[model samples]
Target: MKNLDKLLEKYAKLCVKVGINIKEGQPLVINAPIEGLEFVRLLSKNAYELGASEVYVNWSDEVLTKLKYKNSPMEVFENYPKWKADSLEDFAKRGAGFISISSDDPELLKEMDPKKVAAANKSASIALKEYRKYTMNDINPWLVISIATRSWAKKVFPKLEEEKALKSLWDAIFKATRIDQEDPIKAWEDHMGNLKEKVDFLNNKKIKSLHYTSKNGTDLKVELPIDHIWAGGGSITSSGVPFAPNMPTEEVYTMPDKYGVDGVIYSTKPLNYGGNLIDEFKLYFEKGKVVDFSASVGEEVLKDLFAIDEGAKHLGEVALVPFDSPISNSNIIFMNTLFDENASCHFAFGKAYPTNIKGGEDMTDEELEAHHVNNSLTHVDFMVGDSTTSIVATTLDGKTLQIFKDGNWAF
Candidate 1:
């Protein structure tokens, strides 16, 4: 018990020091599940100790949410509380750093209607579009980290008892985030440097497009926009504050032109979307749109996912993760995108981050649209890389360079 408490404290401190890089006098906001309240309290304490002027928490309960979904009318799903949306906007306006703790059962909403879930998500996103723009543009630092709950742990390690599974999952999370290291902050700094090196290498190549192929029926071509930037590791906010958006991040990604993707790709891992598991899925793209798709499970959910908005059918982000990442090597199916997406190469459908385009943060919506950047209320990532996959880059100068072979960077 003592060791567990110590681990949680250390993890919270790492989040405060490195993940959000909380600045002196900065207000901090955390969105976390009720199951993660212990860690949230620790994080709030750590943030205050690190010079945060104030700490705000937006606590959520999965059971309550499920009950609401089950009992609420369809019209309720369409309404997003203005007060909640305003609060998030206010946080961005005040330059408050944001931290989100993810720890929900993957199947928490499996019994609910997919359309209603999609409606609720879409409505909320629309109501908070301004807030989304602020965060997506990196106006303020934001970090997303994960915690282990009993239900989530059980999903991961079904064979183990509840207590044992929770501990095992916690151990896995700590190791993946390098929190198990003697000096986790220093370890992260070194890891960030290594990732930056890879980004620099890709940027120097000035590739105009990428071609992916595998024996698993993936033959895709993704065109990169002019002045596109491949970003990962730590990112600096508009005010020059540095923060890591996702802990245990292994992918350096860029936005794919909204109208520039063409191929048929198969998912290498299952995607747990809104507590629904989508597996054995394949997407057929034409001119950057998902013209067709099929999934062995959660087919209705997949259909509803792409129907969120017009931009939902277009590609937003293309990320490259080595097939040999620490999380992938662990041989654990977390059933969570936060960890699973980092385990393999993936692509997102919906809104693209403005930071991925050159001078994009300051660009007008029209300008961004002209640059072929996607804009939508949703961003869903699905794994698509494995040992059988290979990626090659085609430079503007007509040079073909190998990027990945057998799912690892070839360089």
Candidate 2:
């Protein structure tokens, strides 16, 4: 009917065609916030046209969860719905592909305890991992993409009405995913190629240690092992070929040395947790392990997170993101690390990256611990990126090389 409507329709077609690779006679699963119901309906029509046998949608809302936070007992935080686990298991068993749209209310969980939030996150991931092992073995396809919902869209542009805000977010999402490109699939191919170059650079450098510094929080240095692989470009096909993870992703990450990190760092953005958000989060690290943490708004939650297990305090991801990203250039404060960390470099605590370690699963706990690859169900990423953030590499020969300055690549 209109240019915008045509674009929206094309975007939906692209998602189903390229993003999900919809197949005939296959069942489709969609998980989105209520604001996405309209788009989900549109997708359902396209899915059915492409021979989808069934299209199931799970519409979510923060209001119900808000009600729980306002009324449920504190102990309810530790519990999870059994049906959710069962459903995911069944989906995996049925060889169904999943497409989850993420547009979380960044501040909704600001008041919740970090520990409870971490526990809940860990529980879901553990169940998903269990299901994934079976699904991945069979090469059952799945895809996840974050769409801007009204609640989150409003947070991004406070001045705009909810509908306009949602539209603005949609614009950004489409642009970031290269949906505007004349050839979107080709754009991804080139983008992934650039990431491969970065990964190759890190591998060739053979950096033994990474050093970081910034105002208000960081003076951290971590020793990396030789086995650690700098991973990006989503990952590989079950057959061990490369593929994209998220459409807009541009990051090169590695698993950090479990016992080789030392410093105190402040999170650049607030973290959404449980049903609350934590801000002004500061953490102290000793030998690649989080020894203590504090957040100005949700200190209680932070404490609970550290209590999950001994390995919960360990670091999982260490990623590098250039400051010149289109998102960072907007100078918008997202308050959501999932989006913000991509604006600059960041790290995470908890579960190690399986791909980073060689034969990690077969290794004994003692052997794994020796390499600083501890096992934990919790892996939460936080943004430590900042305007003055700088990173340098030190070779085993004591040669120093500049890696990043003001969030840009120095190499």
Top candidate (TM-score): 1
lDDT, residue 200, candidate 2: 88
Task: Give me candidate 2's TM-score against the actual structure.
Answer: 0.86
**Cα lDDT of model 2 by residue, 1-411, tens digit:** 376676667666666665666677777788888867777887788878888788887777888867766677756656666777687777766656567776788777665544556666656666556665533332455555667777788888999998899888878877777777777767776887898899988887778889999876588898887677787765654434333445557678888888888988888877755545667888888877777777888777667666766777888788988888866776776655556767768787676765676665456657777777756756667788777888989976789999889868887
Question: How does residue 155 of candidate 1 score in lDDT?
Answer: 96
> In candidate 1, what are the lDDT values of residues 257-279, reduced to their tens digit?
99999989999998998778899
Listed in order, each prediction's TM-score against the native is 0.99, 0.86
Task: Please report, in order, the local distance difference test score of every candidate based on alpha carbons.
Answer: 0.92, 0.72
Candidate 1: where is the Cα deviation over 4 Å? none
Per-residue lDDT, model 1, residue 131, is: 88
